[model samples]
Target: MDKAQIKIYGLLENYLEYCKTNGFTDFEIWCEDNIDSANEKGLVQDIYREVNHIADKLFD
Candidate 1:
């Protein structure tokens, strides 16, 4: 895989571990709450957007 794909994969893996650490097994649910908190904190971009960007980077 390319750098972008590798980065995204790593991020997803990290996120999954984070979810497990927090006792969350559902990715969608975890993402929902994470996205909301990210938005509330005015992060550079929300989790969904980051995921999209990563996807684009991987494919493009």
Candidate 2:
């Protein structure tokens, strides 16, 4: 991952952790902001794809 993707990955990982710790509903109510942030530098899809089940954990 490039620096931007790496940074977004870190941010998304933190969000995923929040979802797991706090419950998915209470976190990431809408992922638009996250997507937009990712789009600023990289694709959120790439991050999710690379992380495998992290997408499921965050958005399943």
Candidate 3:
């Protein structure tokens, strides 16, 4: 993957770790609920799109 993709993946990994540490067992549910928070934090557009796409696949 390119640097940007790698960076996004790292961010995603960190997010998942945070969720797990905080007792969130359902990734899709957590992501669905907190997507707007990520947007509010100004997450990179590509990362946001990738995360949304992954969440859609997981939930749908």
Candidate 4:
């Protein structure tokens, strides 16, 4: 992956950790805001969906 892709992935990984440690619902607003700011719409949606899923399992 390119630097930007790698960086975004890394950041998303960290975000996942944060969501996992906390709660998915707790991070909903942040996730929405991030998805808005993310320049890559496709990637953002993908990450948002994946993270939300992971967070949901943790929350459950």
What C-alpha lDDT values do all the predictions have?
Answer: 0.46, 0.54, 0.51, 0.61
Candidate 1 residue-wise lDDT, 1-60, digit = tens:
755445444556766566545543433343444333433333323354555455444433
Which has the greatest TM-score?
Answer: 4
> Which of the two, 1 or 4, has more TM-score?
4
lDDT of 2 by residue, 1-60 (tens): 766666665667677776666654422333345545545334645444544455465565
Candidate 2 lDDT for residue 20: 67
Which segments of candidate 2 are over 4 A away from where they belong? 25-42, 45-60
Q: Model 1, residue 46: what's the lDDT?
A: 35
For candidate 2, the TM-score is 0.44
Instruction: List TM-scores for all candidates, in order.
Output: 0.39, 0.44, 0.41, 0.55
TM-score-best of 1 and 3 = 3
Residues 1-60, candidate 4, lDDT per residue (tens digit)? 855466567667777777667756533346444443445445665566666677788765
Ranking by lDDT: 4, 2, 3, 1
Location of the lowest summed lDDT over 10 successive residues in candidate 1? 36-45
Put down candidate 3 lDDT per residue, 1-60, tens digits, no spaces: 755455556667866666545633334434444444444334454355666465445444
Q: Which regions of candidate 3 are displaced past 4 Å?
A: 23-43, 46-60
For candidate 4, what is the lDDT? 0.61
